[model samples]
Target: MMKLREIAHSRTGDKGNISNISVIAYKQEDYETIKKSVTPEKVKAYFSGIVKGRIIVYQLPNLWALNIVMYEALGGGVTRSLSLDTHGKSLSSLLMDMEIEEEENEAN
Candidate 1:
């Protein structure tokens, strides 16, 4: 097992109560591993407490990235919410902490 952060980096953006996080693998070869582990269902489950609505995962094979769009996930919009991480800037780091089973190679 390994933390997602070990293989990928992320950036986050927000609009209203939605947060969009992009997870980019450090190596192109790692993209497939990330794609297998970082599904919308998995992400939603990982952030279940904070994500009250739907989660959407968009694949960006060209960039070796995955964009996870979480709807109604901010507790409320930044302007209306009193949460410390209003814009959810800290969410990216939080997401990177998710653990996943590392793929085994046949060569092993």
Candidate 2:
């Protein structure tokens, strides 16, 4: 299973309940694999079963990586968790659970 290292994470905005997340490769070389793994479609798929919101993906030219921002996920500004909730879903868990198609892997 592929593993992702969380480089940074934070809320979407001061009052919004959304989660904006950033992650990178544990090993810099893994950036290619990570880029191959994460796509706009994959980002949408990642949050499909667990979160209800809009997911935006952008490529980081400088880093050869990607970033996904989950908007309006925490039920707007009404609810926020204090504990594990403070942390979005585990990066490792998300990567492990992903279903990467064979064709995509082959293209990489």
Candidate 3:
């Protein structure tokens, strides 16, 4: 087993009360592993405490990435939130902590 960070890197962005997290695999071959492990349901459950709305996962096969959009995630819009990480920039790192089963087929 290994953290998702081992195979991928992420970026986070926010608009209104929503957050978008992009997970891009380091190698094209790892895209399948990411797709299998990082689902909308899983992400929503992972951020259940912080996010109050739905999670959407979009596949970007061309870039070997997944774009996860979380709605109503921020306490409020960035300007109105009291949380230290209002913009959710660090959310990616938080997500990178997610554990995934490493398969023999996974790219190095």
Off by over 4 Å in 3: 106-108
Candidate 3, residues 1-108, lDDT tens digits: the string is 899999999999999999999999999989999999999989988898999988989999999999999998988979998889989889999999999988684355
Clashes of each: 0, 0, 0
Q: Which stretches of candidate 1 lie over 4 Å from their true place?
A: none
RMSD of each: 0.8, 5.3, 2.2
lDDT of 2 at 11: 20
The TM-scores of all predictions, comma-separated, are 0.97, 0.56, 0.94
Q: Distance (Å) between predicted and true CA of 73, model 2? A: 1.5
lDDT of 2 by residue, 1-108 (tens): 322434221223323666555545555655666667667577767667544777776667466556666765554443555435444545334544455432234556
Candidate of highest TM-score: 1
Instruction: Evaluate model 1: give its lDDT.
Output: 0.94
Where in model 2 is the C-alpha error above 4 Å? 1-15, 78-108
List per-prediction Cα lDDT, in the order shown. Answer: 0.94, 0.53, 0.94
Candidate 1, residue 41: how far the Cα is off, in Å: 1.2
lDDT of 3: 0.94
